[model samples]
Target: MNPLVSVIIPVHNGAHFLPDSLASVFAQEYRPIEVIVADDGSTDGSAEVAESFPGVRCLRLEKGGVSRARNLAVAASAGEWLAFLDADDRWFPRKLTEQVALGEACPEAGLVLCRVIHRFSVDIPEWFYGPTDGSAVTAYEPSAWLVRRAVFERVGGFDEARSLGEDTQWLSRAWDLGISHLVAEEIGLERHIHGANATGLIQNRRVVFDILRESVERKRARRAIR
Candidate 1:
């Protein structure tokens, strides 16, 4: 039997998209996996949408934020591996199969990430996704990751203080700690860049930069100590 994977989804007022996202996860259907939805205090029927799917554990939280929701869900999870999915994004049919294959092949790796397809509508600003057309192949999304539970614990939960780019901070910190990672060549996830998405908001982008700067300074300070 394959190892179990805990799929953690953080949702807030995402009723309109939960069905599709949940459907995508169930479509994988190739391995023993548990689905967990951390509902971040959504009043727009998001919890109901998540519950409609059989076997999905929905944790209704007090709108603390996505970071907090993820930490809480992880605390409740019982799998050796963890995969994160946002309510607005989805996974490809073979997302788990490919990730698990790579994980088993590289047992030493604590993290695995796959290429992603970013979809954007015409309303999104041209600067938001420069040079690339409607589709862009990118990395660094938490949704594209299949990380080990131990590695996640060592890195600690996401920075609850941050409302944006918490994933960036978490991944950066993991890398700084020298956690081994494996990359899957397949495009295993699709991130829909609707204008309402946080990454599209200019203010949120600033927060991402701040997180990056902090990571860089941490690295520099560590090098100085060496």
Candidate 2:
């Protein structure tokens, strides 16, 4: 039988958190999942850290954004499901197992997202849920979502053109394809936020988010026309 899931982790100057991230992935309660770590021209020791793992496959790419690195990783991996994780983030032991169970329970659900606990620099922790969650939520943490391998191919993987908001844009495309999504309220991912985080690029945040919104709106409009 094929593995139930594949985990992709993109590393760029990720030496600082690679150990914890790999540990979290290796500790996953679920078995039969392969972990693919892609290094995007990291000058630091990120590649070395990834090599320390027993069953990890590492890919090297030019210095592109996270999206490009992820695309390369996905192309190199072979699994039924694709689960993306940032090198700076960690996952709960049951994250993969819970997501797989959810997929099995809802055959129509093409994507499964779990709640994420975001630790900010101010020492404050915030919980982010999916769109179905109440208005109190802040934003959707893309890393919390698990997608089918077919969905990735259908959407052409992440837009390499996008330096940010890659996750939102990809999900928007999935929504257009009549993909159903399930959200788990349990804390399944931990996103460590710091100054060096790529998503924090202030100049790109607004533009990327706008692109994401437009992508989603276009999908909604298409659905209405259908």
Candidate 3:
């Protein structure tokens, strides 16, 4: 039997993009997968959109942040592996199949990351960016991840205190615990960049800085202990 994979999508007022994302999930070539749409108090019709899809489990929650919604979905899900997708992002048809293959090949890997292509809503001048910058930011997004449920549990899910950079914090904690990660060369995710993206919000910038500072301190403490 194929190992069950649970795909979790946490959204807040994401009705506009939820359908496309759900379609991508439904189009997956893999079998025995469950899709969990965690609606984080969306005033829009995000819950209705999620419920419109057959077999999709929609979990309604108060206006908690993305981390809280994801944590709740994972807690209610039953799967050996967990795959996360942002409401505005999409997975390629063979995404799950390829990730599963990679996981099987690297049994020691606790997490598998796939290459992602970022589609920007607006074009910027080529001269304005460097090779290391621009749409490459999607490289570190949680949407590209397929992780073992046990390892996720061991890392204690995402940090609810962080409104932004929660994925980074969670991954950092996982790495600190010596959890192995494998990167699949195949591009499996398409991240849509838009004006309203959380990363672009001014308040999230401060949250990002706080997360970075905490990460640096944790690293320094680990080094001192060693």
Q: Which one is best on lDDT?
A: 1
- lDDT per residue as tens, model 3, 78-120: 9999999999999889989988999988889999988777676
Model 1: per-residue Cα lDDT over 75-149, one tens digit each: 999998999999989999998989989998898899999888777654656446543453446567788989999
* TM-score preference between candidates 1 and 3, better one: 1
Clashes of each: 0, 0, 0
- Which regions of candidate 3 fall more than 4 Å away from where they truly are? 123-138, 202-209, 219-226
What value does the lDDT take at residue 138 in candidate 1?
Answer: 52
- How large is the C-alpha RMSD of every model relative to the true structure? 2.1, 4.3, 3.2
Best candidate according to TM-score? 1
Better of 1 and 2 by lDDT: 1
Candidate 3 CA-lDDT value: 0.86
TM-score of each: 0.91, 0.84, 0.88
Candidates in order have lDDT scores of 0.87, 0.78, 0.86
- Which residue segments of model 1 deviate by more than 4 Å? 130-136, 202-205, 220-226
Q: Where does the lowest 10-residue lDDT sum fall in candidate 2?
A: 127-136
